[model samples]
Target: MSSGALTAFILRSPVFAGLLCFFVCAGPCPGREDDQARVLYARAQKLLSEGDPDEALDRYLTLLKKHPRTEWSALSLWDMYRIYIHQDSPEPAFEVLNRLIVEQPGHFEKAHAAQLQLVQRILGSGKEARTNLESVKKKKPLPPEIVVEMLKTVIKNGPHSEVGIQAHYYLAIAREQAGEKTEAIAAHEDFAETYSSHELADDAGYQSAYIAYKSWKSMRSTGPHQRENAAVALAWFIARFPESDKAAQARSCLAEVRAAELSELLGLARYYEARSNPKAALIYYQQIASRFPEVIQTDEVLRDKILSLKGAEEVVGPVR
Candidate 1:
């Protein structure tokens, strides 16, 4: 608007005065802006309560646009989201939520709380009204992006918070289900390390180690690298949570990984020997013997072959 018309409008309407405050003394007039926001919000609430939802929505939209950075904008966006959803306008409802989530950087707690309410409403509750485990147990979880946003808000608020800890664990789960195992592992490990005293700490730590282990174990063509990853993951879980209920399972998985690795090394050694490269064969055999002495000693035939290669390597010398 022209400066003249704008000034006239600002003078004519008390609500429009707040909009001009932004133009005249934006950063310096927080008190004015906040007070004006409350006025607008009260006006919107009265309109809504009087059954003039359309007018209430307009008031809220104006408040959001004029005082976007004020805390009242958060309430405005939330009310707008509710109104859109009540009207069955999915697109606008999503837009309002995105505005709260993405544009309003100051409302981390509000955003997270709103998301939880939305999730609870959409997914239907089980026996517990409040649970750290609800999202995972849902038959149809919210979309990955929504869960991610919720997690981000929770994390941004602070991991020491009760809700933040739950969010950290759930965020890893969401990433895992989205096939981002690397990110999932990192998130889970972070949660475990940062909240080692919490009740779910062991669960987080095991999941961190298990994601990579499970992937390697399930692969059709498990390479040496994959076996090594599996072994390391299982070993980590065993070390980190030695008293955990899952410790025995981790031990079993680690043994399987070791066995598979030993098999690969033995196969490589035989392949080298078949190629007339006894020097390379000796190296692999020695590695397998060194790494798996218990397993090798129980197999007399393999032990004898390693001894012979050692004898030959002593006479012929190492490959290098």
Candidate 2:
């Protein structure tokens, strides 16, 4: 049939006009572009599945250009993103994801999830760069504060999402990995308290407490005394997260922290005893005897001194 005859035949049946439009479009069909865009999306997906990414990309770009503000166009960007990612072209893939985030609006739940994945990719880009030892030999680690702010942004944008929960948990891990123990302790505490029912909450709580326990050891030589703080934090971990895998080690470390406290008390006691202040010395001696029997009572010589002190209390408090 000639073009005019075929057009007349198609027009006579509404269903044929509709169905044939999907297969043959001579020019722009303004009112039918929505269906055309939908057809393009489905065609692109099929082409992609058949391993014809180049053709798939062409169809996606055509849809995006003709249907700029439509749902099909928005959906096209994600498939384009997948193609770029599969091609190992991260720059385009990442750009497409960014476009999806900015241009997306409405009940596009999958689009929102993709946006979060972009957030994770961007924040972890620094870590990825560090993975290839030779490539990043001269590169410095991401500043701990910067990593922290990025994760905080996710929590602000999507607090209840799977991404947000992970971001909150990783904020502390980032701090700890960077050796910012003080900041790590603070961040971990926040995660545990804010998301107590989350799967990672116990791990967060344990990290904060463990950092508190480990920090004093390095600081004691040149910094202030933190034995009591360490002991308190570690003991709190055991009580609060008894079922945590790290709790067993925490219990052992609590003993070490108590021992440090005992050593400090012994120092103060000896200082007074050397100056002939036996009564003041007896007070700390009594504290050590009462508070840290596991540490002090094991030594026979120390045991004799405790037994000799008249004002010393014969108390042996077990560590909680």
Q: lDDT values of the candidates? A: 0.76, 0.72
> In angstroms, how far off is 267's CA in candidate 1?
1.2
Per-candidate total of colliding backbone pairs: 0, 0
> What lDDT is reached at residue 176 by model 2?
76
TM-score of 2: 0.60
| Alpha-carbon runs more than 4 Å astray in model 2 | 1-67, 70-98, 105-141, 175-183, 220-224, 271-277, 294-303, 311-320
Q: After superposing candidate 1 on the true structure, give the runs of residues whose Cα lies further than 4 Å from its correct spot.
A: 1-143, 157-159, 218-220, 318-320
Query: Which pairs of residues have clashing backbones in candidate 1?
Result: none
Give the per-residue lDDT digits (tens) of candidate 1, residues 95-174: 57667768887765666555544533433321223322113222444566665665566566565667666767777877
